[model samples]
Target: MSSSIPVSTLRRFHRSTLHPRNTSRTMATKVERSPAGEGADFRPPWFYTVARVLSWTLIPATGFYGVFIYDFGDHEHVFQPARRWAERQKAAFLTLSAEEKKIVGNETASTKP
Candidate 1:
């Protein structure tokens, strides 16, 4: 049976199970966020958002969605939150730096595979 399973797949499954799924949302909002009026510029980093979702089986909220942009200068567009990414305060976001805070702040157009 082990031979039929890819090592990577096994690792992923094991990791996910180990983290355990959160049954926080059975019907209402799937994700959660900080209360209104925390920080005017309060938004989570991109990687941080992803990590938050990945880390949890179900995201508590969907405050803001960001898409990665290429250029790294004045031409570059970044940090836009239509919703709130306040939930990032959970371990997944706090670790990031201010610069990271900036990049992730931008609204993402796509997360294409």
Candidate 2:
């Protein structure tokens, strides 16, 4: 499970690769200059600006529309059907338990103090 490479091996590889044959020549980076006046100022294209605006605007607009649809546009309207269904389910369970109690007939005494 050892993940480390030997330090000696790394040092050897670094020395072989970095030490060039001509020690007199130092590695100075060469700069290639651009022509005259092109690429001095940068301005984005028209469609790019439009795309960025649309992306930002559409994202929030979609979120607002989604919320609006959930709130007032859908058939049930703001989780009302869900609430009513839950209440009906609870009532049904209570009625079924009451029938079971009538059938079972008092097996245990009340434990409340």
Candidate 3:
């Protein structure tokens, strides 16, 4: 009167139906390569090599020149505001009384726990 199959019966049924006993061989075959220098190994054109070498040389050279040689002088508008602010702060610090300078210096040196 039981409707459920046993675990062994279910496993045997799954093994026979879900998986085949023998697998079929594949139809694909491997391709044979052309021998040595008959275009098996290819070299790029001369200009491509020259362009690659120039790119490797010129890009780093341009970056180093920009970092070390190029100067903006008075035309450096981006940093001018910050430079002016620093100058004003230095003037203000110089104008402070000796006691005020001591207080400011101590405030910066003290760390809060």
Q: Compared with the true structure, what per-residue lDDT tens digits does model 3 show for residues 19-94? A: 6642322111111155555444354468779999999999999976665455657476555666668678889877
Which tens-of-lDDT digit does each residue in 1-113 have in candidate 1? Answer: 34888899988877655545533342113233434564323445586688777767443322222332233455434442311234354556557687776666653434433
TM-score (C-alpha, index-matched) for candidate 3: 0.28
**Location of the lowest summed lDDT over 10 successive residues in candidate 1:** 60-69
Give the winner by TM-score: 1 or 2.
2
C-alpha TM-score for every candidate: 0.18, 0.26, 0.28
Q: Sort every candidate by TM-score, greatest first.
A: 3, 2, 1
The candidate maximizing TM-score is: 3
lDDT of 2 by residue, 5-112 (tens): 888887887775556752433321111133435433234358779999999999999975665434564366665666567679889877747658855554433433
Evaluated at residue 81, the lDDT of candidate 3 is 64
Rank candidates by lDDT, best first. Answer: 3, 2, 1
lDDT of 2 at 54: 99
| lDDT scores of the candidates, listed in order | 0.48, 0.61, 0.66
Instruction: Give per-residue lDDT, candidate 3, residue 29.
Output: 14
